[model samples]
Target: MPLVLFVDMDYYYAACEELRHPEAVGKPMIVGTGDTAAKMSGVVESCNYEARKLDIRSAMPVAQALRINPDIIYIPADHDYYDRMSGRLMEILKAFGYRMEVISIDEAAVDLDSMSYEQGLVQGKRIKEEIRKTLRLPCTVGIADGKVLAKIVCDSAKPDGLKLVERKDIVQFLSEKSADKIPGVGKKTAEKLEAIGIKTIGDIAKSDLVSLSSAVGSFGFELFQIANGIDESRIVEHYETLSVGRERTLDATKDVQKIYLLLDELSEEVYREITKNGFRFRTVTAKARYSDFTDKIKSKTLGYWTDSPEILKQTAKALIRELIEEKPIRKVGVRVSSLEMGNKQMKLF
Candidate 1:
């Protein structure tokens, strides 16, 4: 039996801005919007609740967001800034003996099985307070028996709130929520479920398992488990990243040789990143995006683990040769994934 805790930052970009600029307090803010000559371009990366009230949102066209709130404070994404802050935050959490699982740039899951929920809550609160006082960042915390319930509780505790959902309270907590509140239950999935008369978590929990499984395959059974608070997913010590990549938006160039040169540089960079983490990968992949945003990924898995830049470049070059389908390239990337610790030379039953 383990306790899972989810920590979700509120309007991460906006909060990060507020931390850097005290003058931004109490103002509607949006990130990733740029003042550019290009019309209907750029996207909102994140927005404060105040800006969200005006329909400003992440990944929405900046022009559309301006239509909702012309005065919305806009800033370009500061990923380096966020990364530094996140690193500090992770260090603090790790000190508390929570095995961290980074879910995204702004969220994470921590396993606290050895600690009592009440003590976990106290620790969670202290972590929040420390983040606010030291980093000037706002965050939400949720605790439950598993990752799914923890995420649900974290969602409900948004805008800088805290909540704990224990096993006994799962059903009651989910009874009145929308089906979409369950992870993996998106709009299309919910509509399909509704077509079969499943609109709420309770409906899903009590639905016929066999019929549900037939509708969505193995995913249906997984959803049913979440609906009934039966999640068994654990917070693994090492993150199982499918890929590690580096991309660059290059200046327009028609020379294939120059493009390949850049790709080699990117491949070497990616290889260094993987080896630096003491990992070896079997798959090497390349991505090319045309000026029109159309993109394609080509991948190859070697029969063995490789952390060498030479092999990665060779694989990427072969993939690029086969990518005659794209137009003038605007972005190029190299990736290595299917990773495993290089020195864990052992076998277990």
Candidate 2:
């Protein structure tokens, strides 16, 4: 049977902070915008395992975390640093040549269909060890026959460890896990499931599909599949998004120049976002919502894929002109679609 392997960096943001100040490796610290004297005024973006020992958690108010440990090391978040490091780490994983899915900034899943269960176990250990040795950052690895089981096992093995759930043990492996153990079951979904007395993975696994579909629509049916270790999702090397866009509802206006200015701003923002996420697109679209709440859209297809703000803005402006006429506009949007994977670099010979 193919093994699905999940890898999650241990307290990723905090770990990155520790790597910068090696003395803090075994010490408690947090990365956020809060200052101790600011009454712990900032939100904790990430906390080291040492801080976690005191029950300090991510998204907790900085002041509350300080109240938990007045001396907790506090540092601001460095997003650029983290993004650069994440890119490098992903490159390393991509080199492994497995079918891969990057689930988060610090988490990924890989399929080892060409290897045996025992081989998967060996490689899982290797990946965990190499990440720590090469990057000096700790991670956890989980190996199982299904993606859902692998992710659950990864959670139980957090902050640096490996866990393997064999194919024969899939049901028993998840029997006691909370319904929220499944990926899509957030707080609200968990509350709904618990209200209906479906409190465990095993409960959902055995629940009636028709009843779940009725209660929660298609999401409920999806949860049923995950609960039963039936997650059929595949591992891709990277995620492919359908669109990148920015839209706004605005004060009614009909001036052509004013509308052009709005299109310029939206185009810049949309293009910036797509560029940051490494996307290029050949289609630019513009939408206008008139005071009457009537909406119209126009699209233009570029001859080639691009991540250029100017190109997008020009195309969107032209398209909007074709759609906007005499109507007092209440909303405008710019969207770039027909995306390509790479963040292409311009070159001149």
Candidate 3:
């Protein structure tokens, strides 16, 4: 049996902030998306364990977090810096020469095909140590026979911890866990299972396939397999880019000129990246996030693909105009999708 290692950075954004400002270590801190001048208006992107203990959470309004802890530290998000750190982390993982899948900016799964469980544990510790020594960031690792199980184990041992679930122990390890503990079992799926008196992984393992299938459709088979400690999920080594985009928070404003200027700037940034990558896009999208956190989006698809900045800017402006009429926007974004490689452009009939 193959073993897979899932690595997840602990409180990634907050950890990155602490790396740069060592004084903030062990303090309740959050990395948020609001402007520095009025951080309370923004949303929490990530928070440290200290903040978690106070019931603060990601996507909670910063104002609500402040209400929870009046003195919690706040750091605005720096996505560019975080991306650089993520690149370095991936490079470190690459050095191990194992087939790896980048799960997210802060998570990855590496295949250790046919490796013994004992050796997998040793490699897990080495990975944890390398990330800590080089990046000064904490991470957790979970080693199991399958990627999903590895990720579940990794999630259970968080904030600088490691665990390995050998094939022999997979059933017992998963038996008592809630069905929701399975990756794809969200609230809706859990509700469906509950309706059929299935509440635990053990229940699913023993469930009648016909009933389980009736409850959740085709996904029921997957749940049944997962509950039985059988996982067929594979590590996808490459993920293609489907879109390019950028967003920024700003002082609350309805000023059309200021909004348009920012939109133009964002469009140019998107244009530069797509052009650099030799992609010509047929769709442009504009997004507006209101002061109260509600958002609206509009998209326009062109009749043909082109790499024209003017069309990108003009289409974005037109789309955003319909959104901004309702309220003062606190943030705006632009995206280009339906992408085709410039070299792959098709001839018109």
Per-residue accuracy of model 1 over 4-123 as CA lDDT, tens digit each = 888888998888887777666787777774333332577888888888777667888877888887877667665546655765666567677666776765788888887787897897
- Could you give the candidate ranking by lDDT, starting with the highest? 3, 2, 1
- Evaluate model 3: give its TM-score: 0.75
> Per-candidate TM vs. native?
0.75, 0.71, 0.75
User: Which residue pairs clash within candidate 1?
Assistant: none
Q: lDDT (0-100) at residue 226 of candidate 3?
A: 85
- Candidate 1: 10-residue stretch with minimal lDDT: 32-41
lDDT of candidates 1 onward, in order: 0.77, 0.79, 0.87
Clashes of 2: 1
> Which is the winner by TM-score between candidate 1 and candidate 2?
1
Clashes (backbone N, CA, C under 3 Å), per candidate, total 0, 1, 0
Task: Look at candidate 3 and give me any clashing residue pairs.
Answer: none
lDDT (tens digit, per residue) of candidate 3 on 23-49: 778889989985567687789999999
Instruction: Give residue 169's error in model 1 in angstroms.
Output: 1.9
State the local distance difference test value for candidate 2. Answer: 0.79
